[model samples]
Target: MGSLRLTFACGDYDRTRALHEGTVRPDGIELISLRLPVEETFFRMMRHHEFEVAELSLSSYVKSLDQDPSPFVALPVYPSRQFRHGGIFVNAAAGIEEPADLRGRVVGTPEWQLTAGVWIRGILADRHGVPVDSVEYRTGGQETPGRIEKAAVDLGEQIRIAPIPEDATLSEMLADGRIDALQSPRVPSTFRPGGGVRRLFADPVAAEKEYFTATGIFPIMHVVVVRRDVYERYPWVAQTLTKALHLAKREAMANLYDSSALRFSLPWLIPGLEEARALMGEDFWSYGLEANRNALATFLRYHHEQGLSRRQYAPEELFAPEATEAFVI
Candidate 1:
């Protein structure tokens, strides 16, 4: 049979650039990669099932598993991961000097189901003694208006979450102290140049490194998923795609070590790369289930604790069996 033609949609990241540029082709597959902004790709895939393969929010993927017929099945490929300590911004005058001060305060988030929000809330609760239900949560667009939760979540009575005014946004609310803090992946418009917003952690880089030391978790934000129908039709596609993505990521990582020239624009790129390797070890940005099991388990626990997932899930449950294991030579 001829190679299967499949559409894969995801953000344009260096790790996945090889796949997008046709430098790495999966076995028995003709990949058509559509590079789009994460928000657009996520909306189209989640709401309309637009692509055969796509990058999806980790929290949203976990939530979707509870559906009668889950919409998608994921590979063990993590396209995006980050330390979320930098994403939490608080009103400078809200008396919120530290994470604990967030208790009894109104915090705004773009959505309850956002992957970044999930990680930040979990970290606050686990490391900083701020429980998930301790603060009131306001959800709305960060800069624009009329944003709503994409995935339907039932928080029951334990969690307090509501929407900001239809005319208002989280950025403005945070800037003016209507909300005591904001947690989001995107920086608020008012955060720059004395716009009345500052990161909760003044030195977020230090905070993030400290957090990693304590928890050993570099939070995962997004995963590659295959539409359920597509997976069912070609069971082997999962493994093929997983292998191709792993190869692509390896090439990207290897490129950073070339001392003759800079692979990225940063002035101290070599030092930064060396520092990351020293701290996290090689294969820091890893693919597959085994390498990331602990982190994935932590995220699933957080998803359940924050009322996003119905119950805690094993990291193994998130990906297809084909994608979870590899053939031994």
Candidate 2:
């Protein structure tokens, strides 16, 4: 039989470039890769199951597990990971000098189930003194108006969540001090000089490094998922695609450390890579279930604690069993 064809949508990260450019094809499968914005990819995939495989928000994926028949099954392949200390933007006049000061404040988030928001909230509640429900959460668009949660969620009465006016945007609300703080992966327009927005942590890099030291978690933002129907019909696709993703990530890491020439625009890529290796060790951005279990478990715990998930979920439940292990040579 001919190789099965599958549509895969994901961000154009260097790690996934090998797959996109046709250098790292999955075994027994033909990938029709589409480089789309993360938001668009997520919205289309979650709402309509637009792709056979796609990168999805970790938190949103967790939330979807609460559904009686979840629409997707994940492969422990994390396409995006980032420490979100810098993602917390606060109004200058809000007097939010520390995370603890966020108590009883109005915080705007693009979506309650956003991976970045989940990480930010979990970090605040875990390390800092901030409780998950201490602040009132207002959900709306960050730049434009009328953006809704890509996945439907109702945290119920215990956690306070409200939607902003259809005509309103989080950026403008944060700038005008309508909301005291905003948790977002994207920087708001009002984050410039005299724009009345500043990160809660003045030195986010130092704070993030410190957080990693404390928690040993470089937060995972996205995971690769196959539509449930596709997986059920062709279960082997999970492991095959997982292997391809791991190979692609290895290629990107190899390129990152290739000192012959700069692979990225950053002038100090070598020093940065060296520093990261020193801090997090080689293979810092590891793929698969075993390497990432702690981080995954922590995130799942946070998701349940923040009332996003219907019940606490174990990390192992997130991915397909076929992708969780491989045959030894």
Candidate 3:
């Protein structure tokens, strides 16, 4: 038979670039990669299953796992990983000096169970002693008006979450002093100069490094997933895709370390890369479930504790059986 043609959608990340550029191909499969913004890819995939395979948000993927037949099964390839300590923003005038001050305050988020929000809330509660339920949660578009949750999220009574009014976006609320803070993966446009907003951490890079030093976690924002039906029919696709991603990421990582020439659009990139290597050690951005167990477990815990998932899931339960294990030479 000829190669199976499939629709794949994900962000444009260096690790997955080889797949998009046709440098790596899954065995007997041809990919038509749709390089859209991550948010567009996610909503289309989750709500509509718009592609045969796509990168998925961890929180919503787990929410899918709770259904009788989960919508998709994942590979260990994490295309988007970020340290979320810098995602929190507060009104410059809110008097929110630290995380503890968030208690008894109103916090707005695009989605209550957003992966970034999960980590930020978990860090606030676990590391800073600010309980998740201690504050009221509001939902709305970060820059535009009236955004709503895309998937089903039932956190039940301990927490209170409400939708933003039709007239205002979360960023507007933050700027106008209606909400004390906003937690989002992207910076709200309103926070630009004279916008009356500021990040909770004045120096977020230093804060993120401090957080990494303490927790040994660089939060994973997205994982590659295949529709369950596609996996059920072409079972080999799971392992094939997994292997291809590993090979692609290896090339990406190797390229980033070439000190003779700069591979990215930043100055002093070599020293910055060296500093990261020195701090995170080798395998800093590893794939496969085993290498990321602690980070995955930590995220799942936050997912469950925030009531996004019905129950906490171990890393093994979250991915295809073949994805969790591989032979490395």
lDDT score for candidate 3 against the true structure: 0.88
Best by lDDT: 2
- Candidate 3 similarity to native, TM-score: 0.96
Candidate 1 ranges with C-alpha deviation above 4 Å:
193-195, 327-329
Better of 1 and 3 by lDDT: 1
TM-score of each: 0.97, 0.97, 0.96
- Tens digits of per-residue lDDT, candidate 2, 178-243, equal 999999999999898655899999999999999888878889999999999999999999989999
Write down the lDDT that model 2 would get. 0.92
How far off is residue 160 in model 3, in Å? 1.2
Candidate-wise lDDT, in order:
0.91, 0.92, 0.88
Q: In model 3, where do residues sit more than 4 Å from their true spots? A: 193-195, 327-329
Q: Residue-pair clashes per candidate, as listed?
A: 0, 0, 0
Ranking by lDDT: 2, 1, 3
In model 2, the number of clashes is: 0
lDDT of 1 by residue, 1-329 (tens): 89899999999998999999999999999988899999888888878999999999998899999987998999999999999899999998899888999999999999999999999998999889999999999999999999988878889998999999999999999989899999999999989745579999989999999988887788899999999999999999999999999889988888878879998888899899899889988878988888888899999998998888888999989999998874221
Per-prediction CA RMSD (Å): 1.2, 1.2, 1.4
